[model samples]
Target: MVPDDVVTYPTHWEADVVLRDGGTAHLRPILASDAEALQAFHVGQSERSTYFRFFAPLERLPDRDLAHFTQVDHQDRVALIAVAGEEGHEKIIAVGRYDRSGPGEAEVAFNVADDHHGRGLGSVLLEHLAAAARERGIRRFNAEVLPNNAAMIGVFREAGYVVRQHLDDGILAVSFDLDPTERSLAVMADREQ
Candidate 1:
């Protein structure tokens, strides 16, 4: 689906406080005005989460880097933020994004705050992204995760995705398929809409 000419705005904005096991947090779409929050989220991530997300240790990003990330066309890309709740407060806890690389294929990516790991928010974010991608006719989802990120690998496995490990240049990466059940869920979600 093509992005609407009208600027994309956050809809049904409410804090999705996930109280299951993990600490509660807010889940919402990233707005164009959230560049500072996004940058802060990236900067404050643990070294491991940063490496997992960027495939390397980035000391700190300049303004240009944040701009490129925040100013994408909504037609083909989406960014979601998970901020800390009443307990954690103002800290960005998790982040996820989906980018339509081509017809039937979307690239899915996510990261959670270091202290908030193992709480299952990464999987929740991924599920939301996969459903969003499916709604946009994306059936094949791909991710580039490092070899040591067991939590992320677990997320993919829980989603019933198939994984094929390979090395691209020197960085370890895994490609996966988001199965039909995920698609069905996306469809059902659309019906509810």
Candidate 2:
């Protein structure tokens, strides 16, 4: 377990999760060395997936953006990635992150590889991220998801949180409290079983 006093890294957050498909994936806090895997994950995503994630047709992840994404303080800014495969061959299949935007709120986002969609990566990441955020005293999460991205929306809407959302222009503004309520914990427990 990572001591609360350690502000630099939180390796205790790493966990092994079982996906909906009965397969397994490793979830861990983002590391500086993950830049290459993150880049490859970005490059491998379909055009539609990329558009949904970045809201633009970004063909490449710029160096600055890559650096910013890989580096996190594990408190106000946190990112977790899901990976599968062997040690050296492990590949990042999904990425989820939350950036604090207010005194008790943070902007959350996620990107799951197209080929690995529907395997429960988004929901698992959300649970872990919420736990991490709560430990840091964050109480709320806000997300801006493209309205047409039903996959991502379902992950949040069905997460058992009291979700409030509105469509502005074409983007969906989503917000929910991070505290795990009875229903939320039940849903997570069911998924775990």
Best by TM-score: 2
Q: What is the C-alpha lDDT of each candidate?
A: 0.69, 0.92
Best prediction by lDDT: 2
In model 2, pairs of residues that clash are none
Local accuracy of candidate 2 as per-residue lDDT tens digits, 9-120: 7888899999999999999998877899999999999999999999999998999999899888888999999999997899999999999998999999999999899999
Backbone clashes, candidate 2 = 0
Candidate 1: C-alpha RMSD after superposition: 5.2
Error of 2 at 141 (Å): 0.5
**Model 2 poorest ten-residue lDDT run:** 1-10
* Cα TM-score of candidate 1: 0.78
Give candidate 2 misplaced runs (Cα > 4 Å).
Answer: 1-7
